[model samples]
Target chain A: MVENYNDVKTINTFEIKERSYFSILWGRFKKNKMAVISLYFIIFLIVVAIVGPLVSPYHYTMMDYTALYQTPNAKHWMGTDDGGRDLATLIVYGLRNALIVGFGAGLVEVFIGILIGAIAGYLGGQVDNILMRFVDIMFALPSFLLNLVLVVVLGRSLFTILLAIGLTSWAGMARLVRGQVLTVKQLEYIEAAKALGASNLTIILRYVIPNSVGPIAVALSFNIPGAMMMESGLSLIGLGVMPPMPSWGGLISQGSRWMLSYPHMILFPAGAFALTILAFTFFGDGLRDAFDPKTE
Target chain B: MAQNILQVENVKKYFKVGKKDLKAVDGVSFALEKHKSLGIVGESGSGKSTLARLILGLIPPTEGDVYLLGKSIFKASKNEVKQLRREIQMVFQNPYLSLFPHMTIGSNIEEPLRLHNIGTKKTRKSIVLNLMEQVGVPPQYYNSFPHELSGGQQQRVAIARALALEPQLIVFDEPVSSLDVSIQAQILNLLLELKRKTDLSYIFIAHDLAVVEYVSDLIAVMYLGVFVEFASTEELLNEPLHPYTQTLLKSVPVIGGEIRDITISGEIPSPINPPSGCPFHPRCPYKKEICEIEKPILKEVKPEHNVACHLY
Candidate 1:
């Protein structure tokens, strides 16, 4: 690329390429082989989360007295825990909860973060000072501990877990969005907007926000897995969704009780969490490459 | 005579530096007739660009007023200020950083139209295409990023973006000063062509006298924070009244002229703590007791020409 631009200064840009934004983004995204592979892995995780439980042979909740603490077999692929619940079935049922909390927290946090940070960055006065101070305060606290306290206060449920993670998780995105807006608001297009009779709000939302989507996209993709892992960590530690509702964390917590005897119970759920986080992180890396053409 | 399109009435801008107020623009005033270009020439710290910023309302004044179409820009309400913005725009020096890197060339051009709500989306598309055409950008390049274009093309797009609103006055603040010599000539020619086709007015600011003379209808020589001389380009070049303006012309590299470019001896003073009376006194070889003690007012030396110096 350096070699390509070396003459560099004198290129006839008159008949430049017909590269649309989306096409360029898509083209760059396709170039990252690792990210594409991770994206497929994430899609597979999504598929399992929504449909895995229905196809499980044994019921996730129903206890079979005859096959208590049973080892791996044709009926129960991942073997049974001390309660005789199908380990494979439990992993299957846990997917729905994992995806919901991950996606919900990710979406809500990014939305609030982008809105607040964009406003704060573009306004850049008393509002930026106050809001960013609050963000700094929240940022200093341990997110996991915050979730633990929230679950205790709100009564540990899947919904509360989602809300807690969503509320505390926006700090990263807010900072990212604010940084992006700080750089983007100074752009000539923004001044052009002001010079064209555009109101402050119009300048902010139309010019500032849309132009700032790249960083927000990167921040969103990066934070989703962190939210999911947080939810699972909370559940694993008994501060997350209660025993009856299946979660990767709940399964891991249940499996840890009999870790010596039934290792398969804990291993599968923990493995799922690890892989999902890795996939999302890789996807985020790919997206950054795709969205930012300056890398080209 | 052309109706006055812009009248800058003793504009002063003071910013805090260290502890004292650093006067960026100190009582600078000039009037530009309609469709006429004013070339503001000065050294780096002479406040030429700041005066252009003052005229464009990029920053507000501390102790004076700027009138556009004969109305106070400072006292105007938000709606009034915004409406005034539609008629004037500015282009910056660094073409590389001027454009939003993420947006397509077309959308960047269309941005001003969207801001004014001038027409529907379809109308904006056509306007952008026409503007791009006028600026010598092909239809294919509309969707490209700023990085893809050469420095000259980017400035052309910046030109296209400036022309988006059909503004009457476009301020070029060292617009070509950042580019190479070849690209600089290209951008200068483009601005001249634009003025010819659109009948637009310009406030051209530069550190060099030669470039300013080429594109200017009038030239205002700025020293420290004031215009030392303001006259038609031909008159100012032929008979620069202010000693500092003459020093500037003397400094210009000449091919066959008898006056050596090695004439001017001293540098411009820092604007923060300028000279005691006249900002040009220390640099003026003909400095006297009165020149060191008394600041001169801009006096009309010839018809439609003014100079601020003790001799004048």
Candidate 2:
């Protein structure tokens, strides 16, 4: 038996190199048509937000007395707001501001969540109990109320709003990451890592965190839209981005006052806001589907 | 004579389940010589896997000491324990779960070398490739993820990873149980070849008596977290003195031989609240009055043959 084993020739076939993580993700991501369309729409929205103001004849802060509440015409596209500021310029710049807050606050939330969740999950025992209990307490308070309190105390600014939304939103993410870590830690590879003499930090950063990225990525996509909605909610109550800065939420708030006479003002900004949120939701769902290992 | 590589002295691991203590490993004692394999045979929950974990230092023993090359592991400092990991490695039962699914096979094998800071990046790659060759894993599968490989292939990768550090002792915890019968023979042969090539000592844990006999020099038959018989492989196979060991041997299907009746009865007792006297007395066919009233200690019946039974 040993002789026969030794006599067998080694197969030396060479194949193409393995696909990278991004390429594989892109391959799966392209299969869903709605997700692909949503991605393109988001990208287009971002481009318009960035470059649209620069190309327009009117600036967001520019007010013309003659064009007040003008309907859509060739001279001033998408009409003019009550302030006579170009609605197109305000909407585009408003989108830019919303995107900034969404990404900034979303990243902050994910970072804090991952840090707390990874530590809680990897350490386990007393440390896990303490941290998870803290997360549970945080979850008990309505996030909007928490954000409201923070905005009121800190005095509404872009940074304070970002901080409030980020601080309030991470409890859900931390919980998700903690559950994922708990499951991943029980796999035999973790024991194998421990047996191989890997330190706790190295194992957490290299093995545990990397494996938990799929769920984290999905959570992150969902968080962007969530942050944007929170910022909008705060804005509706006069605590959002201060006027003249032109946020989507501020525009909607301004438009609501004139709702009886001209419904176009509310319709324009609300439509934009709804479209942006829908795009994010669709994109996040696609990511969740793409990253689902069971689908593979 | 070869020096002793491992000495497990009266190791006990008890877990607190609610109000009662589960005696997972109850006062097990044994020593393994350098370059020899000691097979521990037992049913599931017999504490065979628990004993392996204790030796690996994955879980701390409730009592007793494990000495590797004359250095006490339980008493070692943090740094000493870290260094001890290099001397011992393990191959877990489920190959699919044992390897990281995200990493390629080559990177998975290279993980330990990186963890220990053993070699440069170039040297680590070369070492991984060499290990892949040694384990008969095709070079082409090196870049593939674990899920891409068959169960047998994944096990070969796991073994190669265990061999990467050149540890003196490798604990095989039913390493072939998840593979097909034909693949089991292949993996067994591979293990035998690796043993011959590296002069590595092994603590092979399995419930299959035949598989254990094929690889082990010394055999230990465990019942309810304690050894019922300890002897040389040949002696235990030829003449098992303990009734538990005899019933276990008869249960192994032998082709073209007179089939003996399977005499063992009763389910294994729960370790949380085991019987007061001998653990096997409830199932032993030759249980006497003494067997039910008092526990039996392992007593030597012949040279290198110890049986823990009243009959002995």
Candidate 3:
């Protein structure tokens, strides 16, 4: 038995590289093939959104009346829309705006969520009651209608759309973060931190926030896609990015009338929108499993 | 003579659960001299943990006060209470849970020092390295996260963190219970060696009589949130007076001696609605009619030996 144990120990003594918490998470994330592929796709889309329009053969507003409602051809790879604008250029610019709205609103949602959630969760009692009641009211409201009203009132623009979606959508994220903070704050480590004389703020920022990062990240991933889809929906109704500014939703809405005549127009923009949203969902699902503390 | 390192003047902690109040620690009192170890032995729900929390000021007592170095913690100002933390530390039962999961072992050990703003960055690093060395943790584990290390190693890191500020009193709440039997002995021996080399005092809480016997200069046996008997280690082990204490001793299997029959049965009653009169009366084999009607206060039956029983 002793010899066998020694042999097993020797076999197990091969060099294993040291890993930090993030590295461990990355290792788990890498194990999911679909998530990894989705992550790469999202990165590619972001890169395309940034650089695609800058290198497009024609400007988004440069119309070609001769090619109006044209099908896919050498001159216009994805064909021309009703305005005869290059479908490729329109799609690129639309993607850029959509990406901005998705990520920008995502930032807004995460910030507000963490701030309200941490405060409410850490300072329970009357404060919790007031804040959570407010959250409950927000949850009761029709989020899409609220977004629509804000956009119509504020006027259509990238900034307005991002704010409308972000401000209205943060209630769910706040509730998620609040639940995470509640559980994390009750752990013995938090009590240990308190016994070590760490202040309430330090405990919240260091212990509560770091422990809740997994759930928050997962929530943010889903929020990005949710925000993007919401933006598309708004744009489809003609209140999103406005004219002269191409967005996936605006392109899809314009191409719908000419769908039978030129299917490529709606197909290109809608396909990009659907695929990006799917990528984010897959990535979010992957993150949920990867960041789960109990997985190991 | 110098003052005792710690004094608990009838500290009590009652938690409101729904409509009823659970008296977790009902007016428990004790004092410890410098460099002495007081072992508080009790099974689950005996308020041993609550007593530790009260002493540490992690939770406010419902009544009474805890004094550290002649200052009442409950009566002290906010800053004063915060300052008191530097003089007292705690090692939790589960080393894995007690440690900050995101931090490396070195940073975990250095946390208390950093929190108190003690020493420069360079000095703190050196102090952490020295502590790790003293605790028998390897130098290579400095960059390792808490989960990377084994249970024994994580516990050593915990001890290092507790010792960073050189506290006068350290509370060990079932610190060795989470480890395996072999690791338990190793950690207990390390604690004993640490006590021998330093002027540190301890309030060691554990459910195991044998483990407590190895480290404690004094012993207090708790049941249902109150101490039933208190005596020196040798005195309590050799001549336990309270029926509950004897029942606990008999439950432990002796190495060479014949195992005494267990007289106690059934689980401990809930603190919310404990039995009338003596809390141990229902489980006490030598119970009398008087034991059911009147509560027994801990009183001395011998020099420095106390028992709370109607027979006494």
The alpha-carbon RMSD values of the candidates against the true structure, listed in the order shown, are 4.0, 4.1, 2.9
For model 1, the stretches where C-alpha displacement exceeds 4 angstroms are A1-18, A54-59, A70-72, A187-189, A291-294, B257-261
Candidate 1: DockQ? 0.46
Model 1 interface RMSD, one decimal: 3.1
lDDT of 1 by residue, A141-160 (tens): 99888888888898877788
What shift in Å separates residue B109 of candidate 3 from its native position after superposition?
1.5
Worst 10 residues of 3 chain A by lDDT: A10-19
* Per-residue alpha-carbon lDDT of candidate 3 for residues B130-236, written as tens digits (9 for 90 to 100): 99999999877887889889999999999999999999999999999999999999899999999999999998999999899999999999999999999999999
Better candidate number, 2 or 3, judged by DockQ = 2
Worst 10-residue lDDT window, candidate 2 chain B: B1-10
In order, the B-chain TM-scores come to: 0.96, 0.98, 0.98
Tell me each candidate's i-RMS in Å: 3.1, 1.7, 2.6
Scored against the true structure, residue B156 in model 1 reaches a CA lDDT of: 89
DockQ of each: 0.46, 0.60, 0.51
Task: Give the 10-residue window scoring lowest on summed lDDT in candidate 1 chain A.
Answer: A8-17
**lDDT of residue A221 for candidate 1:** 86
